[model samples]
Target: MRSDTAALTTITLPEIRLRVRDAHKLRGYFGELFREHSPLLHNHYEDGTFRQQYPLVQYKVLDGTPTLVGLGEGAALLVELFLRIRELDIDGRHYPVQAKHIEHRTEAIGPVAGLRRYRFETLWMPLNQDNHRQYQTQSAAEQQAQLTRILTNNMLALLKAVGAYASDMPLLLVHLLPGEPVVTQFKNQSMLGFMGEFVANIALPDGVGLGKSVARGFGAVRRVD
Candidate 1:
């Protein structure tokens, strides 16, 4: 007879996700949540380094329910914060999300080569000194070039910070998927940041986020397949 564990495969989740009821009502600054329950993390990681090293602990309202996600190091923080805080109140409603009760799926890592195309629901590529002059009149090709450079830098940084020594720079390709990109609407302005599809030449594990403001609900992406 085959051992029960013989075929078991380990799924290295690129991100850890948790669910909360009445997720749509969750509001207020993400910094507040960390400061209140995970103060040390707030002071050391969340303040700045986190945005560079890992995606911040973030929540999103999907299907009318709130979902909490941790990326890379943020995963550990998510688990700890939920356990310590037990329940939290954001905006005005209460969320009884506990680490024990938090839900997750047993997953197995898939081929890194298979994960190429990705869809971004929100992507905010910030202005940099290098490209500040091209902000207004940049052509589509130029914009793509800038994005590729920025993305390459961020990924390399993540690998270095995590001490993943074999990161010889995975192949990456950027392009826009044919369709209307999502636009962010504000009371006074309408901004269309980076939102589209990316086809990487290498395996980018599922749940890898890119660009800027990923912690605050921008630049969240998943493998298209």
Candidate 2:
């Protein structure tokens, strides 16, 4: 009998769920992709670093009656290609998969606020493949471009699954840096020490001042650290 006691490594990706005026259309589009990418059973190592053994593809739906939509083998093939394209060596580099979730606010708030609210929860998981020192050596532009690429790729893939075009939405990303208190909360919950450097943001579509207003409300959190 095989022991089911494999070490568990959790990587939380908090995504900013963009609003689609047509939810039914969006669901029909991504339903296929979700079914394809999520593995019925995943196997990986728990060494707390990025090894070749870490599974690169994963999927789950939360807080809504959203269905699991995957493109099966087609998505698997894409994942394989994505891995090849990335070819990110873990031996001395660190990257994080930060998820951002955005939702519409039914109730209204302060003066001149839009009818939507964007809530961002950033979960940071360090890649042990590379030393932190080596990873920070890149120019700021290089770092932001790389981070944007990783994030946009995932977003595009998910959007493709749902049959929606991100080009239509025109995402305005506001990157954020965490403060000491927020870091403390994450450390307590995740048992992983916070680096105090994670790309978290509250994104808003056009015609919305909610994200901006929220950013002003939380003054301590810097745009970038």
Q: After superposition, how far is residue 193 of candidate 2 from its true place, in Å?
A: 9.5
Q: Write the per-residue lDDT of candidate 2 for residues 26-114, one digit (tens) a residue.
A: 23333233334433212223443322322222222222211111132323433333322211112233323243222222221111212
C-alpha positional error of residue 217 in candidate 1 after TM-score superposition, expressed in Å: 1.4
lDDT scores for all predictions?
Answer: 0.46, 0.27
Give the clash total for candidate 2.
31
Ten contiguous residues with the weakest lDDT in model 2: 211-220
TM-score of each: 0.61, 0.26
TM-score of 1: 0.61
In the order shown, the candidates' Cα RMSDs to the true structure are 7.6, 18.2
Q: What is the C-alpha lDDT profile of model 1 across 24-131, one tens digit per residue?
A: 223243455556555323324445453234543554543234455554455556665554544556656565643333533322222244436776644544444446
Model 2, residue 24: what's the lDDT?
29
Lowest summed lDDT over 10 consecutive residues: which window, candidate 1?
Answer: 1-10
